[model samples]
Target: MDYHNPNYATSLYHFIPSPLFLGKQIAPNAFQTTPKLHILDLSGNAGCLPEHPELSSMPELQELYLRRMQISVFPAEIMSLKQLRTLDLSQNSLQHIPQGVKDMTSLTQLDLSDNNISALPPELGMLEPSLQVLKLDGNPLRSIRRTILDRGTKAILKYLKERVAED
Candidate 1:
């Protein structure tokens, strides 16, 4: 499902090739048409689309899969989906998980494995009591200790919590 090709298969939209050879396209308003769309799986696109398409129109979105999108920047635009419970951003080029993620308090499972993420915002500590599963196994984290990461989600969250307290 490579969005870079535009002809990729998706459960929602069908893409037909246009003569336009636009460098890169970000459909900021694409999701607005389907306001009730809940589970969107855009994984394996391997496309380096920079802008986080504006998906705030869909308040019911519970799960979003942006794995392997080649996304370098954090998709802050779609993070507006406060009801999101599951978010997978694995296998991308992300270097940082923005502090804005703290607003998605409803997230229970967040998969950010296999990315270039170096450090996590201590604000991630705020997701506690709600966030139960966090996948950062394949990332090269700077602030978190390997021992804590090996201890799994609870330990990682605890580390984040402690960092928050120290600030």
Candidate 2:
């Protein structure tokens, strides 16, 4: 499942190498035989992926990729891992993030670009405490005034404060 290898190349649209153990779900007892893993790629498997508790048991998991998985709702269970610092949910069908997502304070980088998010909850700014970079480039939001974006991210930060503070 490690496509990050320096020599990796592919002609197919999408694929990951084997023996790295990529699946929709890893049965509870399945991971006991393997050493603790650092990276887990679950991209494109959310639909068929079983809602298993074991998915979050990897104590050393740092990076998670779940792009284009058609998951509309956020998985709150993954937020419990204090070790996770990066999360990618690009190109999914997510329109709204569950409230519990604010609990993932360990995240330094988060990608939610190209989803169907029309409006982000005010709580999303709470991520700023640890969030260094956030991507919301392609969404159907109809209210971003040109002046706001032109004003730079300060405008967005102010907007998030006003919107979430009201909640």
lDDT of each: 0.78, 0.65
Q: Each model's TM-score, in the order given?
A: 0.82, 0.71
lDDT of 1 by residue, 1-167 (tens): 55565333223332322334234454666665656677877666554244656678777788888787788888877678988999999988889888888889999999999999989999898899799999997888988878888998888888898888999
Regions of model 2 farther than 4 Å from truth: 1-25, 28-35, 46-48, 142-158
Worst 10-residue lDDT window, candidate 2:
8-17
Q: Across residues 57-132, which tens digit of lDDT does each residue of candidate 2 receive?
A: 5656677788877777766667776778888989988887776677778888888889988876666667665777
User: Which has the greatest lDDT?
Assistant: 1
